[model samples]
Target: TVLTPRVTLQVVLSRQYGSEGRFTFTSHTPGEHQICLHSNSTRMALFAGGKLRVHLDIQVGEHTNNYPEIAAKDKLTELQLRARQLLDQVEQIQKEQNYQRYREERFRMTSESTNQRVLWWSIAQTIILILTGIWQMRHLKSFFEAKKLV
Candidate 1:
């Protein structure tokens, strides 16, 4: 295994102390990608200390598509290749239901513009709390009519 400009992928069959090996390759360049493995067995009874049990399963998107191994190498006729794999799984479930209806219409227009900006900020905090309770009731009724007590 050696991807990128080094290029060597699919020659897998070596691991055998209980035997398990699988190989598949497809990547044409996107960013940060690399893989390298080597054990061409210099043999002291197969590398003197044998123990490699790797169960790496990396499946990225749309169900790791193999398309029935390309409809069994294009001979096609198992019911016309299962009706072309049911029309490519109904066009990948109609592009995942149109990307979940475009993410539920962009999360319902961002929850109706955050409930209309919290209803205009609760009507501007109830008109500044009723004009600060009518300016503190005309400043305690002009300080109780200038101290005449009423």
Candidate 2:
């Protein structure tokens, strides 16, 4: 089911044996979104005739393609096949570009967080070093005075 900013769909699929289906969800919003699917049996009996299997595939946007076989069986010409292939490639490239942008954004945020942590660590180390130096100097002065060395 698709729940776009302007439209929403509440899909209800009946659970039955040997049933397979696919659904597409298109969103105008250009960000990551969750796509979910649930499958359940409605049979009341402990067991049904033989075994039941349901396969559900959910595809979003341009990732949905079930036409290559059809095109091949129809004996499409080389030029026609090339065009279809190019179209598919374009769609795939767009999807990949979006995914790359998402990853880059995530990586940038992580880099910022790591930089802040490193800055704090450096400050802590400097404070510790200064405190240690001061303590050592005071201890050495007290020892020299106790021994009347100056």
Q: After superposition, how far is residue 75 of candidate 1 from its true place, in Å?
A: 5.9
True lDDT of residue 115, candidate 1 = 100
Question: Model-by-model lDDT, in order?
Answer: 0.68, 0.67
User: Tens-digit lDDT track for model 2 on 1-150?
Assistant: 333332334332323323465444445565544444444556654265546554656565445655667577978887887788778888878977997898899899999999999999999999999999999999999999999997
**Count of clashing pairs, candidate 1:** 0
lDDT of 1 by residue, 1-150 (tens): 434433444333333332446776555432234565555556575466666546767774446777778777987778987787777678768766876897799799999999999999999999999999999999999999999788
Model 1 lDDT-worst window of ten: 9-18
Which residue pairs in candidate 1 collide? Answer: none
Q: Give the lDDT of residue 101 in candidate 1.
A: 90
| Candidate 2 ranges beyond 4 A from true positions | 1-63, 68-85, 147-150
Please name the candidate that would achieve the greatest lDDT relative to the true structure: 1
Model 2 residue 145 lDDT? Answer: 98
Error of 2 at 121 (Å): 1.0
What does the lDDT come to for candidate 2?
0.67
lDDT of 2 at 124: 100
TM-score of each: 0.39, 0.51
